[model samples]
Target: MPIKGSSKGIVGRVGSLRGLSTALMLGVALLLVGPVAAEDFPLRDKYASVGVPPVETGELAGSLDAMTVVDARSPYEYETLHIRDAVSIPLASRDFNESVRTLAEESGQPLVFYCNGVTCAVSYKAALKAKKVGVKDARVYDAGVFTWAQTHPEHTVLLGEPLQSTDQLIADEAFKDRLLDEDGFYARIQSSTDPVIVDIRSQDQRQGVSLFQMKDRHVPLTNDNRELGGLVQAAMNEQRPMFFVDATGKQVRWLQYYLDEQGVEEYWFLEGGASKIYEGMGLQ
Candidate 1:
């Protein structure tokens, strides 16, 4: 299957392979893409010899009582929504080895790692890492949070808060207000003198983008972005309204929570993000 959010052009190009199994199709795509250059693509071959077998969603659902589930996505992704009872231990974290060791010692149960889905390599890498560190039973739930959310929404948890239906989440006023549309964001930038626009897009994404000119600072939104807490502190010290934006606006929700933890009260995120602004301004 075409990766989620892949363009129609890509889908049409891959249409001839519709008869292939999803795993086979993904393998073909990976071959064409060549290695896990992007964060979204998983390094399936990296752990091929690690012997971390794929666990199906159905098996995971049935085996939850006997296994410990670890979310290999970032804490932000975990907090946004995750398989219920799964512990967050981002694969890319410095503390990953320690976390796995702790989890193994604490639970003494089989550990399952999962991120976005089969398309994401985090869980595979995480499982391999765990095995390398002597957690012999580490396994990858190949069908990850995306599949779990679709097939078992009731088993999903959000932000350590009360379990909420998708509709309820949409209707939440607090969640709703965090989003500022292109027009609203433009007006805020133009009129609001106190709030500083914080561009959280990757440095690569920021290149040649006119919106970067409006930003008071640039901090790429990644779990490994060491400058994140410092940036948050700087914004807090200034006590200015903090406006955040990412490539698609989704990542800002994670940063919003980060700001909240840092005691930031005034913040907003661009809805639909820089892409929307580019579209609105008729820029490529």
Candidate 2:
């Protein structure tokens, strides 16, 4: 959620504007998603603006079975939770286009791709790539897994079981508790008890240099909770507060579930991930 009137999700920060390209993409996508008023947000900046219309219930009403709903997120995210009958084709994979072609050719159905929400660009980017690779029947579901699983729990699965409650997602307050701006983050680093700073960006997203040269641990973020559990265990064993950074802050939202599940209470997420250090992410 961006501050009441601004496109950026955080409060009181100035940086280079991401508005130009974002606005242009949304202008093109709105024609597909349906008519929108100035007030209809998330569409505006609640998530990444895409050059394609995102799928919603109206688009799939009676044809959900006819269309292939592809999860363009990581395997770990898919394993954690996903729409029923959806197939995973991570956009990050090297064979992403070939995989999409194989599935599209095999199924011969319209492909509806989705990811972490409008907040993330994986789904839309996947659709664009599929189209570029000549898969014309591709589409995007930018609303993301969190929204679908919450509103349609019966059609969702969590940890290999049918999802039971909307509670599976982290609450806003819980997320807020772990969120820290650059200033607050740096301030805490000066504490007598040194905190553990972990970088959870994937290999591709790592810009090839450390943000915290003195003590930054590289721990790539994955949906496979086990790796994260290992970090949590280490933090607990050493009695250290953990600080995690991702490409964008959105990933930590899902990772929070693993942290809570493992009983790791003291942790913080970079407000907009490390990208915020260079430029505000998510619709700045």
Candidate 3:
């Protein structure tokens, strides 16, 4: 039940660009296909059928007291910055339908969905989906959290510490910049001073020779693992940095983002995952 796009499998497949910088290439790719403008919000013709209307930022601001504002972005995005009192129900969640239904049934106010910006479609899609499930009053505040922060900084909220802008939040949530190559990871584990490695691979995946001689703790990543939070909390309470590893470095991204949302900031992931470690140590 990890959110879509959470796994390493979904990481952008950058074709060979040996001469070009990876970061620069990523930036250009994002620029080419990034969020659309407010004017270009998708499914414009279908809004009427969905019975969801677009709520302008100003209107949403005025009506916050009267509406149930739901952030429809990923947990990472929601934790980074959101409307002061909005609750998050990410569009990517497997329980999204149930969450929306429960919120609709419990709250007397209309549901308002918002994400990063007008270009982001999560809010719109969430609103539509909610309406499809009988939440007739779902609304999309397409202006998004970033726009709200820019216009009404005092009315924003963040997960852990205060940040000045949405850009900072994006930077903080970036995983690629924090990835540890095999050598770096090996060095860290050998030192055993700072980060405590947490292997999230499944039991089957751990059947053979373990990386770092299996010195790390095993905590399988699953959507409904109730104990996962407790395990992470214990690590945080001990004030130890966590470094996560999975089969292919994909699962750790989801785990990392989830940890970030929970206010656990001191963490990193092994680049290319356990496979990389196996290859590096000639275990492969």
Could you give me the TM-score of model 3 versus the true structure? 0.48
C-alpha lDDT (0 to 100) for residue 50 of candidate 2: 40
> What is the Cα-based TM-score of model 1?
0.54
TM-scores, all models, native as reference? 0.54, 0.76, 0.48
lDDT of 3 at 36: 47
Query: In model 2, where do residues sit more than 4 Å from their true spots?
Result: 1-53, 223-227, 280-284
Better lDDT candidate (1, 2): 2
Compose the digit string of candidate 1's lDDT tens values, residues 52-157.
Answer: 8777667788988788888777554664566777776778667678778777777778989988766677788889899889897998886667557656668876
The global Cα lDDT (0 to 1) of model 1 is: 0.64
Indicate which candidate wins on lDDT: 2
For model 1, state the Cα shift of residue 113 in Å: 0.7
> Weakest 10 consecutive residues, lDDT, candidate 1?
18-27
Report the candidate with higher TM-score, 1 versus 2: 2
Sorted by TM-score, highest first, which candidate order results? 2, 1, 3
Return the clash pairs for model 2, or none.
47-118, 48-118
For residues 106-218, what per-residue lDDT tens digits would candidate 2 score against the true structure?
77888898886555677877888998897878877766776676667788767656777765555566578788898898887767286888888877777677888848888
